[model samples]
Target: MVRALSFCAASPPAAGPHRIGAGRSSEVFAEGPDRVVKLYRQPFEPEAVVNELAASRLAHGFGLPVPEAFGIVGRAGRTGILFVRLDGAPMTVRYAYNPLGLLPALRRVARIQHAIHACPAPGLPSQHARLRHQIEGARVPEPLRRAALAALDRLPVGDRLCHGDVHPGNVIATGAGLHLIDWQKASAGDPAADVARSELMLRYGRLGPAWFSRLFPVRMARRLIAAWYVASYRAASGLPNEAIAAWRLPVAVSRLFGRPSDTDAELLAAIAALARQRPDSESASLFSGPGRSPGRGQPECCR
Candidate 1:
């Protein structure tokens, strides 16, 4: 059964609130000293808001460090969620200045992700179902799409909580500790699948325009960060490389459904290449070897 929560009416118009952050689908506003409101853009789905609310409550009930979800609110003809604001810099911004902190930061992310998977998330949508939907809808070549669907079928189904999107940007480092935000994509499924999604985002997920990503230094830094993250997660989860790799195709397809950007071309090509290869092909070699890729001994970024 779907859990229901009431929506509170906003005191001030949505546009009047001081904006703190913005993402593809929503804009976060500082409602007060201890709370914030995330107002979705026009034409947003109410179902998504409901899912986030229930998922946030579930994570909090498990004693996770997620913010307390006060309730939903309507402001300026938009739906928003009221949450306790934890004032802290996103892990991404923190790492940008001190690249040397990359590995430990990723390790911390791994621990938090693992802890999320340890809790049961009943009443949440199924990750497999969501991925299957994405695979069916992805605008990839037909063969690759079908192959991804087949791969999804072969994977095991699980009830463990999966933070659909667990990237550094979504994690906040407060004085109390790290708090995982953005529960909109949370689901219940195989923990390996969730880890696989994170790996794809950290490694190949486009950060910005293709032109900016083409720079040698930027590309190298991203690769190093991604490689270290995968390594750290592998060590922490004790899950074999193959287990995570198996979910790559499906996860890649799902990523396509996100807001389109200039980097879509490269992402599509990568997905197509993986789809053509056999499940056990040498492509899995990407996850093997020290540091995952041939690079200088531990780049100063992840010191």
Candidate 2:
């Protein structure tokens, strides 16, 4: 069951901080000796920042390895978040430099994800509601969208905290330990749906524009990593394959709202087709053959 969280307002940080890093939506700046400020590039609702801060505090309270958030701050005409600074490279960069360590890295990733799901976080947005909104707003065929939404409505509602975007890039490996960041998308929901979302982002989500697809070696490495990652997660969580498989289509439909690259077009089409099929007959097969790994030979749904 979901637990209640305390939402405490935090004071804004001081101005003129040194920039440390930048992401698609926000810029990180060094605040004091222990904290950093994440200033958003565009205007966002205050409630979003409040929710993230609450989630961070909730996770930290559960003894999960997450950065501690101080609170929201407004600086330079943009809203920002002040939180503990983690000194480490993202898992993606680390794996890129040491491809051979992919298996071990995936093991750690799966353990951390399992840890996240082990904790209950109430008072956060419901992932089910969020996916429903995304499915309703996606620019896919009307029939596919409707089918996806219907599938989502039939799934069980869960209260576990899901790091909505649990990709390698969002995981930081420090000397102390691994830390999960980007709590902006964190929500309360079914753990299976959360796991399925990570699978989609790691395997099928585009890294950049269409031209990046030409990197065949990199793509193959990613596929290998994705397969191992999903396998590791399944083992660590001890959740049935069918539970995670059930979420694939709805998660894929929600991902369509991101405007994924053309490379994902065929995979998305396969996911839509599977979503329209009978749930019990072939949905599980979409991610695994009779004897193969969970994602090794599956269709785009597993990719």
- For this target, which candidate reaches the highest TM-score against the unseen true structure? 1
lDDT of each: 0.75, 0.72
Which lDDT tens digits does candidate 1 get at residues 135-251? 888878888888898999999989988889888778777778778888998898998799888877776655656787767888677767766776776666666667777888888
Report the error of model 1 at residue 283, Å: 6.3
User: Residue-pair clashes per candidate, as listed?
Assistant: 2, 0
RMSD of each: 7.4, 7.8
What are the TM-scores, per candidate, against the unseen true structure? 0.87, 0.84
Task: Output the lDDT of residue 23, model 2.
Answer: 60
Off by over 4 Å in 1: 1-15, 287-303
Task: Compute the lDDT for candidate 1.
Answer: 0.75
Candidate 2 RMSD to the correct structure = 7.8
lDDT: worst 10-residue window of model 1:
1-10
